[model samples]
Target: MSLGDEPGYGDAPRGEDGGYGGTGQTRTRLPDRAGDVYGGARRGRSSSRSLVTVVGVVVLLIAAIAFANRGDDESAPGTGDSDKTKTAPTAASGEQPVQSTAGGIPAGFAHTGQGAQSAAANYAVALGSAEMFNKSKRDAILTAVIIPSRVAEFESSLDKAYTPGFNKNVGLNEDGSTPQGYTFVSRTTPIGTKLTSSSADHATVEVWCSGLLGLAGDNSTNPVTNGWFTITMKLEWTSGDWKIVTHSQKDGPTPVPGDDRASSADDMAKAVEEYGGFTYAR
Candidate 1:
């Protein structure tokens, strides 16, 4: 809760960060959960497959959703293909980060490797956010960041994965809303990005991130907690921008927990309300 005393995410941008909410414009509700909250329900090549066929499929929807969220790096999107096996660290790329926002999310990423990395970082934040539990917000976010051709596929998988029951388990109501007194906190902070591979039309980037999830309030059973993980997303150059193709997650690269004193529930709640999160991650 008292993240002020803790070290800020090194990759966060110098620009303004927004708070815990969506674009405020709910354009469409893609019935499909779409994008698995970046917890990694993938839109595989198989289209007709029912995500519901396998029980608890999509890898524990709520758990996956709670696993990750936060990053912002500064870099412009580019068009050059990266050399084989280029690993991009969390350093600033010197290029101006994307200045455009498509449907409220960052857009116009470069076709180059750093651009793809930036896209992946920001997309991970959107997908892993608390907003994903809301159908309208979730749909808008997916529409903005996913490959158009595969939007439905991702939605279907997430729809099955992020069910009403799963929502309740994460301390939210079945409708993905917080209870009367508690504040739900779900966010991801990217530590860095690595370009595993890249080409003219496609790229694969892995984001190293730290996430916070659970409910922040006194007597709340789900006290906020944090975790470390890496999200690997396959990206494609589509519609003049890099969008997610399919993504997956794995446990980290975690550092030893610090001995910082934990913040009280009230303090945590106040923090979540007062501070803002980032949308453009480079």
Candidate 2:
């Protein structure tokens, strides 16, 4: 469990980059059984591990409570149309303003209650995306989500972390490129969102998410990876829109999945390249 040397994530591609423990905050728990990353329910583990699980569950519950109370505030209750979309189909949530657009995607967002949650979820998706492994797309993402005051610092620091070799090792083409025949998928689905605090000027939202990270292909290294994480964001209602100010993440209370046929590298590669990504919401 050495730092940089730990395989996957930012390391060289593999035909199937076996799943590793989540990258955020690691919990204090008994190590998983052989080949099981989630630690199967074996009896007689240490109390510290049990305490970690309990804390994770409590944080999730708190986030749910916040989401339940958000729109009740009188300042920006949001219009019926937006509210309906936000709740009816999780897909309807997004902070995009009616006018501003970036790369033909929604750019600016209206400052409202729903907007904050939408911003949080979308930003979580972007921050955890495969694009974060590449310099250009990573820059675009930071510019799109981060508050202006912190953008430069954030970009510079992250630029250092996502080195060109690191990008290549993580399955990107040389020159921080995207290769043909492979679909890069690093996505997050927010189980829910909650507003920790808010005002007309700023808001903080937490999003609990499950994610996939991998490249699909026969000879591929770093074949898709998966994990559970929670993203907490501090946002500013800027120029009639919501922008992320600062953010942090922690690992999960993830459940164990049953054994299933692991797909071949070629099949994974084809599926990844052919499938399109979505704007996840909850």
Candidate 3:
């Protein structure tokens, strides 16, 4: 229980910048343990109170309220003339990319509309990262993306949510460590982002994300699976950057699953080891 010390729950593990390591770093080797902070893992999505976590009530509230306001269109965030609400091109928009990062999370976004969307998209990646299952790393990520005033509340809620039972359900040991001989994989890749509503200082964004979660190992009950979901983040421009005010997630505008060969546990483990997650952009 000391400040600036390792092995304590209260500590924010620092990087070379004295901040959390950015997600931009790729995995090159397996750690001694699969559950250490940084990357990889999946617990199948379940609804038991013990495993239902992240935003909880807030998530339900936002998912209910935001989509209600936007209408029930599964294909788009808003219902409008087909011409007006068409999906934007996915190529880079030529806007200024975030020039800096905090704890490996992209930061210093523009204060414009594009910036808010970028912030929400990138923030979604960080929030859904594998590191989230680790307490110290989770707190560091909350500090990096959440508005300063609400970090404690987020920490408190998620702390209760990522309980020992939850860990076990996710195929990890009670202490949240990946069991030996298995690779845990949890990752979120933002497919697209939509600006739901916006103003000069406050903005709401919807990020369509594809996620992978579950333990990847032969004979593993929790084999890695992919899911489609959308996360809505309420963001505010503050302290010269965009930070999340509140957010929630709901099952997706999921597409029809295509016929594709599944990878073996060994291959899945190797892919997770070699592939690197990107720092998302608009």
Q: What is residue 220's positional error in candidate 2, in angstroms? A: 2.8
List model 1 lDDT by residue over 137-239, tens digit each: 8888999999999899988888888898998888889978889988999988888888899999999999999999999988988899999999999999977
The lDDT of each candidate is: 0.77, 0.70, 0.82
Query: Can you write out model 3's per-residue Cα lDDT over 1-282, one digit (the tens) per residue?
Result: 012212333333456654455544443534446666423232222466335655587789998789656545554555454433344355456676598999999999998878998999899989988899999999999999999999999999999999999999989888889999999999999999888899999999999999999999979989899999999999998999999999999999898554356889999999999999876667
**Native-vs-model 3 lDDT?**
0.82
Best first by lDDT, ranked: 3, 1, 2
Which stretches of candidate 2 lie above 4 Å from their native place? 1-100, 178-182, 280-282
Q: Give residue 25's lDDT in candidate 2 (0 to 100).
A: 39
Models sorted by TM-score, best on top: 3, 1, 2
Error of 3 at 206 (Å): 0.4
- What are the RMSD figures for all models against the true structure? 22.4, 14.1, 22.5
> What's model 1's TM-score?
0.68
Count clashing residue pairs per candidate. 14, 14, 9
